[model samples]
Target: MTPAPLTRAAVADMIDHTLLAPQASPADVDALIVEARKLGVYAICLSPSMLPVRAPGLVVATVAGFPSGKHHSLVKGAEARLAVDQGAAEVDMVIDVGAALAGDFNAVLADIITVREATRDRAVLKVIVESAALTDAAIVGACRAAEQAGADFVKTSTGFHPAGGASAHAVRLMAETVGGRLGVKASGGIRTAEDAAAMIAAGATRLGLSKSAAVLDGFPD
Candidate 1:
């Protein structure tokens, strides 16, 4: 079948409305959930402590290892299980970027497998590769690890990295590596409609955006 034309709503559905700031409070989370519902985005991505959002119509996603993938595999898995128990429908785990950069694909695979086993089918698993911090080879290897370990998505960044966030090149490379076997999420620094669309064009099936309202407003019909 021919692909359905990408519409404003179609793009909106691809969003994981995010609020991963260090200072975000319960009040802020409440407000985010309310706004997410009004905007009709796919999910609300938050820090694990803010879980159990209870947004009836929206999916709830939370981060595991977060911006830093330095946490031990056992710790990451425990964190993910906690988030899932707290009602997060999805868990975005950070892989050991240092390991990937060092060409240690075994360590990377082990990291993802840890969380994958913890989450099982209870929550969708997304492995954040911090792509901006990796070389082209590392990015490809990271994506391959995620797919091999059964991650549902391969994300580009944590938005907290000094190296910056998602880029079209990384997203395209990730897509090419996974070959539709996994989804690609372009996050961090994606603040404009054009940027979001470009990531999608490059084969991103999902987006993580903290500025959902503004980006959605800028999206063309």
Candidate 2:
């Protein structure tokens, strides 16, 4: 489907400029904020410990339970609360992929709800379903779980998974499932402007990019 190309400002507003590396230091986060400001991106995503990223205009988002969603729900909730307390404006929590894979949608919903309530509307709660790792039905089921759990957004991948990262197919399915009720975030391995555009066309409301500046540089003014 050929969709309209987004204007620079629109594209900027859709980005979550990210730096989720394991060894990322405070200095790197400072640098990320500088880049985010220069690029006019909407948010700067980081690890939970890198919270309180006082980037005046940018939304500060952090990950909970990280690349693996194996952590218990309570543990993830506590982690999210801590990040929020540290000044994160949004929290991206990983769902237990195994539970979803096992056809246990109930567990998945409960797990996400735990963190959602912990966030308590203080921050946007995005649930990462690791789309690259699941079958289509599982993907749909997972998105439903996020919606039922009252998550603010449904995300594609963690970028740390060996399986791979976001794909246009995943984003389209997520958008179709959620329609207008919940937001969809297409993240991981998105390296260029065309990649960003494709996700947007697929109905993703947000784009997570470690290489946000470079991608934005390729967009037309």
Candidate 3:
């Protein structure tokens, strides 16, 4: 039988309403939290500096190694640990893109493992692979490394890469690579409901969206 059509509410539940602007103030983050609660999103992804925030019914997520994944593994681990200590329930860490580009997936695995060990049982670890900047082989290798490193999810982009953001092609490739063993998150450049749906159809289990309200507005009740 065919699956029932997805609803606006269902899609909202799959979103991590995001606000990672470096210039954003506490007031802006407060407003973001308020909006996330009102939207009924599953989580809020913010920068680590804006953490320790509380959103009653939603998960709190933050990034480490951020848009650039050049940080040392130990540094990323420390950042993840601190984020969790600051009340973040989920930590997204960027894999070293240079390592992946250089075909050093073992290095990628080691990097994620450090963050995993730091978060250890305290928070969920999502590895951001920056898919748009990678080749298909690199995407697969990164996903595999993340899985071996004990990541709970494999995410596509950081929304800050000039290489651009999530694509259905990239999402599909990532989904196939992980083979449902881990959650797949499609982020970056996802501005419309149509883009969201395409990612979902391509096997994305979660979405990172800055334009949450605008995208949700396009869906039916």
Identify the leading candidate in terms of TM-score: 3
Give lDDT: candidate 2, residue 152.
89
Return the top candidate by lDDT. Answer: 3
Supply candidate 1's per-residue lDDT for 150.
90
Q: What is the C-alpha lDDT of each candidate?
A: 0.93, 0.93, 0.94
Poorest 10 consecutive residues of model 2 by lDDT?
1-10
Question: For each candidate, how many residue pairs have backbone atoms clashing (under 3 Å)?
Answer: 0, 0, 0
* Ranking of candidates on lDDT, top first: 3, 1, 2
| lDDT string, candidate 2, 124-202, tens digits | 9999999999999999999999999999899999999998999999999999999879999999999998998899889
Question: For residues 1-221, could you state the per-residue lDDT of candidate 1 as single tens digits?
Answer: 77765677888999999999999999999999999988889999999988777789889999999878999999999999999998999999999999999999999999999999999999999999999999999999999899999999999999999999999999999999999999999999988888988899899999999999988988667
Any runs in candidate 3 off by more than 4 Å, and if so which? Answer: none
lDDT of 3 at 42: 95
How far residue 101's Cα lies from its native spot in candidate 1, in Å, is 0.6
- Candidate 2 similarity to native, TM-score: 0.97
